[model samples]
Target chain A: MAKVAAELKYSAEHEWISTDGSGPSVVGVSAVAAEALGDIVYVDLPEVGSTVTAGETCGEIESTKSVSDLYSPVTGEVTEINDGAVGDPALINSDPYGAGWLFKVTVESEGPLLSAQEYAEVNGGEL
Target chain B: MTENYTALYEEHKKLGASFTDFGGWQMPLKYSSELAEHHAVRKAAGLFDLSHMGEVWVTGLEAGALLDYALVGKLSAIADGKAKYSLICNADGGVIDDLIVYRFGDEKYLVVPNAGNAPTVAVALAERAVAFNAKVEDASAITSLIAVQGPKAEAILLKLTAEAQHALVTDLKYYAFNELTVAGHDVILARTGYTGEDGFELFVPNDGAASLWASVAEAGAEFGIVPCGLASRDSLRLEAGMPLYGNELSLERSPFDAGLGGVVALKSKEGDFVGRAALEAVKEAGSQRKLVGLKGLGRRAGRGHYPVLKDGAVVGEVTSGQPSPTLGYPVAMAYVDVEHAELGTALDIDLRGKAEPFEVVALPFYKRQK
Candidate 1:
């Protein structure tokens, strides 16, 4: 089972967002998503200045076995993208919550969100 | 419908493997990182549970004659311990399934088929054997297959065998099998693998599968052997430029279309085999679309069913494509018009409505040092 961070909020599509309500919210794929996708080889992220809509696909993730769409959990302007993850997608599998963060977004609004415990219950993850 | 489980299913669960429903069986897709597993097979060795593959025993005085009549290859010409790669085709020359036929004795042979097509192949063989003095029995349910593949495969096996049988491991020829006791279990060891590596596949009864797997794992510990699953296996075979049954060879395509016409054995065997006339006509007409290897000029890969284009016009379709883990680029196999099948020809694959540049290259993007 994947680990779920208690301080984060999750979406049904498996993206995680920081709940600190700071300047910019940190966002990434949850550990569950990374584990489900075996070996991620390539990641296509939205541009830094691009705007993303909640509950919409914002990028693509390609693994050895298959390809999957990366859905956005919040509607916002992309502030920055994780170049390290873009260069080596395996980092997402190794450290999904910290260095493997996909992007930082200046959130204007968020879609339906679940707490860490809720997410762990829904996705069979461990805290 | 209820799915089937292999004898090693519990072992896979213990290793925290991810499962996928393949060919009506719940099989392991990978244990952890498939990339790591792929590298392990290339650098050291990897253990694989292949019990899902179907095994059919064809025995009798006319076993040789039956296979020669049923399959495309000249099975009777092969030696006692040798194996032949052949295809069972329909009357229209379309391949039903590709098989590996192993001759155990003058009157005994084993036919191994892919998991999904096992029942169909057994039924087809039984139907074709009515006129011949032979019997077909499906033994898939009672058998288990395990493989150790890589450059270190032989070294790992030598650690498992006793000094008396060390010669058997070292002297085994490729595409050949010998009866040997491995890990205190009787197994039919064959130097054959789907990955483009010098490897061995062991056939044993279902009851001994778990212990044999554990013993092999323990013996291969020093050689860095990881338990591999179907994910790495797919990439490995693709990099080796091997044709998968459902992907490269299919009921809609003939052997000539896949560049495997040499296995048809039309001239050497005088006995008329199944699909002889249709295949003869196909041989005379020549294939319209020829299979060719494509190397991506860009980072994006062209996946299956993606349209291949020549100067904005659709010319063919990609059967299988992936990022080659060993070669560090994207490789694919596609069937294109004969004019565009020549090596070094430039083309574009319509990858998700975007054209990506590709060059036609030779099959088998990777090969072992030998």
Candidate 2:
């Protein structure tokens, strides 16, 4: 089981969205996803200014076991990419909810996001 | 489909190991962290439950001759208590399975094959044994294998053995075995391992596995030994440049292509063996593809089935690869066109659609100091 932040909204695909009620929202993989991935070795991020659709794959995450696509949880223009996470992949495993945010997208259309309790249930259970 | 479990399955579950399906067996993927387990093997010691590996017993007066005819290596000449790495090849010279033949006596040998290939290897050996006086017995069901590996492996192992068997543990050379009793149970202590470190593989009965693990774990406690899983074993083998059966070796390629031709004892042996003619042709004409080592230029590691490119054209494919814990960079084993297999050659591994730069380095990116 992994910790789910009550303030963050999560997707079934395991992306967490931290939104301040509009504008740009920071997105990253949830702690549940990061823990399952084991030591993340590389993160391929979508370029800034690129258009991303909700529920679509925008990038990839490579771990020792295998590579997985990083699905976008909202449809918007990629305003910023986390070079820090890209430079150090282990950050995703160490601080998934904080410094490990993948990218930031400008406000646009988005899909249904689950609450902390719902996301915890969706990912097996809370730790 | 339900996957089979090893004798140590309960032990792994008790240790909170995350599970993965490997070669039809429900195995531990990681007990804690793969990197931690890998580093433990390199610095101190690590325990591995290899009960999934297949063990076939070849007994009778013609056992040696049967192995010589079935496998690529000449096993008949191996002295007692010695082991030789060999390969079982189809008549077409394609490798069926790469195995280690341990000669227990003049008429008794144990052929250990990878978990998934064990049944096939056993059937193949039994088929070849029809012409000889040997009996091939699949003893995998009742046997258990545990490996203790690292720099402190010997000292830790010796602490659990009886005083009289202390010399055997200390004097055992690489690739040698000494059968003896330890912790009140019979065990075949083999000085061999997959990790690029000094290690010992203890082969014991299935019922004795738990006790053996307990005793070894207690003795290795001072050495900081951790129970490792297949993930660490895979990364460790990749750093050592060892070929995994499903990855680096397959029926699509011959032993020569994998750079394992040295193990084929064609020059030292006489008489026809399985795949003798096809292997001879390959030996004479030379292999079209060669396995080479690759060092990644960036954080991204090349994975199996990724295309290997040279000058914008595809020349080969990566077989086995991973981010090496010991070296801190990614390393890979790949089969490339013979022309592109030279050392220090600039090449690219296509990760998804992008080509990542790499260089062909020497095999075995890491080797332990003697």
Candidate 3:
């Protein structure tokens, strides 16, 4: 019963991206990743001017049991991060695709991104 | 690694719970989401599978006297239908294991300890009992524990007993237990839990676990009782300011250093127990490092083993750190030097090399809004 957005492009690591001609598309953890990570406690978000590359570490996310790295789906300059999401990480559990988006990137390169369905094929089976 | 499964494992799978390997067992982490389940216990009720914890029965003519020499607390005062928490100590006065002693009768007792430390505790008790006359038996295989926690836990338990055509267990106190017939089997119902919520822990035979879980879940449905896992349980206990065995208190650190001196009975009417001399010495003098609560000023949480510094000098190490569920802010427990351990002492935790501001706060970050 988990939702996989058709329009969103996802990474094998579970980060999702939506490309736009304008600068800075929002990035967030996919639905599969949110369920896997359980209740998110704290999120380490990149600053406004920080530069991130494809497959690079953008920030970090903490659950009750462990801390995890947030991989960047595409390379670009960090534009803005979600302060509200950082305060209440539970918002990410509720809506990992909408206002719970992690950070916005300038999209420097057109990197390879998988569809939501593809990500589910890898992680959504037994778990 | 051993891959043991609980009787509730398949039941949890049917409920769509997230499972994780904990201490070599496939345990439920959460049913829906950890945050949601965490709040459910804070606001409503949550059930947990605590079968992984081990239980040992110590019963003999000298059971009372043997426990008196093996553990720190005086156990002779424990009457039937009562439970007391104490630390099993090493000869050097270090804590071997923290356990709850259940006084089944005047001459019998049951000690519940962590699963990982169960074997060690049994061996130590038996070795110490060589000077006395007692019998220590590991009864973990026959007992299965299920804890129902939260505000409405008692109501749900009452309904389950009535609906199952069984007699309800009344007159149970916060740390007391009694026998009851539920689901056509006699079960030991104890009014104790790790979560800071009001709840009960039921010990039933392994064969009746599946049906009893279903029966209780059905009864708890009306009260919005949610099935929680180890994840919510960990966060809830941390918010209550309780220390985990391996994380906060260990064999290396005495109970006196962990801010749990209130439980130590140094002024016993009789002579001392195993760790009496060293504990008395520490009590007269002071502990070098004291456990204190730290509140991070920002969203970035300090992970475990992060250095706690004062004026650019490493003065302490964080034993446990997590963004608290109730406070909605980063909270952690650390042992700092006596000079910097006082409440409200301003400190900084090094988050991977960057200094994050924090201040010492009192324990039990969140209490029931009395």
Q: What does DockQ give for each predicted structure?
A: 0.75, 0.75, 0.61
Model 3 scores a TM of: 0.91
Model 3 chain B scores worst on lDDT over the 10 consecutive residues at B162-171
How does candidate 2 score on lDDT? 0.92
Report the C-alpha lDDT of model 1 over B36-61, residue by residue, as the tens digit: 99999999999999998999999999
Model 2 segments more than 4 A misplaced: A20-23, A48-50
Ranking by lDDT: 1, 2, 3
* Interface RMSD in angstroms for candidate 3: 1.9
Clashing pairs in 3: none
- Each candidate: what lDDT? 0.93, 0.92, 0.83
lDDT of 2 by residue, B1-370 (tens): 4688989999999999989998889999999889889999999999999999999999999999999999999999999999999999999999999999999998999999999889899999999999999999999989999999999999997788889989989999999999888777799999999998999999999999998998888889998999999999999999999999999899889899999999888898797899999999988999898999999998778899999999889999999887888998889999999999999999999988889899999988999888
Count of residue pairs whose backbone atoms collide, per candidate: 0, 0, 0
Candidate 2 local Cα displacement, residue B143, angstroms: 0.4
Instruction: Point to the candidate with the largest lDDT.
Output: 1
Q: Looking at model 2, give its docking quality level.
A: medium
DockQ of 2: 0.75
